[model samples]
Target: MSLTIAVTGMNARADNPGPGLAVARCLKESALAPRVIGFGYEALDPALYHRGFVDRGYLLPYPSHGEDALLARLTELHEREHFDVLIPCLDAEMQSFARLAPTLTGMGIRTFIPNSHQLALRSKDRLPELAAATGISSPRTQAVYQANFFHTCEAQGWRYPLMVKGLFYDAKLAYNADEAVAIFHRIAGEWGVPILAQSWILGEEINLAGVGDGLGGLAGAVMMKKRALTDKGKGWAGISIHDDELLFAAKRFCEVTKWRGGLELEMLRDEQGNLHLIEINPRFPAWIYLSAGVGCNLPDLLVRLALGEQLLPTPPTPAGVLFIRYAEEAIVSLADFENITVLGETLRFGALA
Candidate 1:
């Protein structure tokens, strides 16, 4: 029997794409040809309808619905599909899966992911502390509970053109106090309390994606510099680069945190050529499929690790390989939508080809 695997984060909208589609694409191209199941929260997640990449698809309850609801749904799906491993590709859902990792293992569903503590340490608000512990530079930031804090922030040396960020997602640049307060409330309403106020740093963005062996070592590493961005500030086009400084920083971060599973490091490079850690995503980035093009194939390595197979260190990816994101329409009949909306699952014929 083929190895059965389920992957989440299937929303592939142009403005805000998720990492699940790229991960499934990597697994589908593997030599083993594992059976791929696309798990999504919404009925219209593009990956669910993309038959060329996803062999089967299912809809999962939102993470906000609580773990019991999610676990119950997964149990029902597992009885039919018998998935052997699950890879969560979104940051917001990582906490839920981390908490349920033991239960999943009991049900014979293996996952390679960081513990809850490791996830907490890498949150946006705690990133400054992590950087300090690792001797990496980070932008100065403050946590705010109320919008009124913006009135007095000027006295604390926080100037105009600051960044207001939510606890879970979304970041907006605020050029003035009025803008700061407005953006804070907008983010807080969606993602919740203790909004972040960060000093804006001017620099180029660099990203590193890698996997950890659950021990103190790293399994594979790939680095990229974003060449183009979407209107929502997501990297739409990027080029793989083999920079020693980037590799060293990624290795050092894994050493300090001992992070397990896939991780993406967002960094900033100033005019003087100093690198500052900006954010640490506990899971893979939307651009992770680029690893396969450059010769690393991180998602495949993650599957081996989850299955308890020993692996050698992955070689560095070749530099200058480019990945450009584009939008494509999938031809799914009305019956396909009904299957997922009403029954919550669907398996496409001839999907594995």
Candidate 2:
């Protein structure tokens, strides 16, 4: 029998799309051909209407609604879909999902995600401590509870052009106190306090996506260098690369954290050739389909691991593989829109070719 898998973060906005749709694409194209259920918070999330990518679509309560509302919704969906595995692709929802893992397991829904402690350790506010513990070099970062810190930060020896960041998402380069304060309020208003302020490092950014085997070993790893970026600084075009230092950093990270499930490591390589761990995203990045392009297929591996199957050693990822992401429109029938908006669910009969 084909496994039923549920995935979240279906929003596909051109600026900063979520990782779920790409993950769904990976799973659909995998040999298992598992049934894909796309879960989103809004009715207009484009991936829900994508014909071949999502076999079924459902709306979920916003993460702000708290875990009880989330669990109730998942339970209802489970009664209808009997999902064998779940992949949550958003950072904001990781806490709730990780906290509910045992309850989800009791309900027969398996998730391969880091536990609460692991998730907390790698969070934005805790990156400094985690880096220090693992012997990784990360820029000096601190949590700012008030926007006023931006204006007075220079007095404390923090120079201009700092990196202002939200806890779950959004990052901006603040060139001066005004820019820093503006960005701080904007991100804080949306994602809430305390916003993060980090020393800006001039460097080339590289990223790695992989699954940890929950035992100090990375199951599979794929690295990429962004060729082009969207206005929001998201990767718009990227090329896969094999860098030993980057790979070693990832291995050391896995060894130290014993992270499970999907993870994205953001790194900045300075002009001096030192790699600084910038951020640790608890879930897959939006460029995750590149994993399939390089033969790792991390989402598929995640599912297999969730199902308690042993993963074969991943082959070496070849350098030079490229992925260029583009925006496209999908025709959504009024009937489907009505189902999602009114009844909160819709099913698609289309099958992948």
What's the lDDT for all of these models?
0.89, 0.93
Off by over 4 Å in 1: 347-353
Candidate 1: residue 270 Cα off by (Å): 0.6
TM-score of each: 0.97, 0.98
Q: Estimate the TM-score for candidate 1.
A: 0.97
Off by over 4 Å in 2: 347-353
List model 1 lDDT by residue over 1-353, tens digit each.
89999999999888789999999999999875899889998888989878777888999999989999999999999998899999999988999999999999999999999999989888888878998888888998778999998888999898989989887778889999999999989988888888999888888989999998888688998999999988889989999987788778888888888889999988889889999888888999999999989989999999999999989877667899999999988777777777888988764673232
Window of ten residues with lowest summed lDDT in model 2:
344-353
| Local lDDT at 280 for model 1 | 85
Best by TM-score: 2
Candidate 1: the clashing residue pairs are none
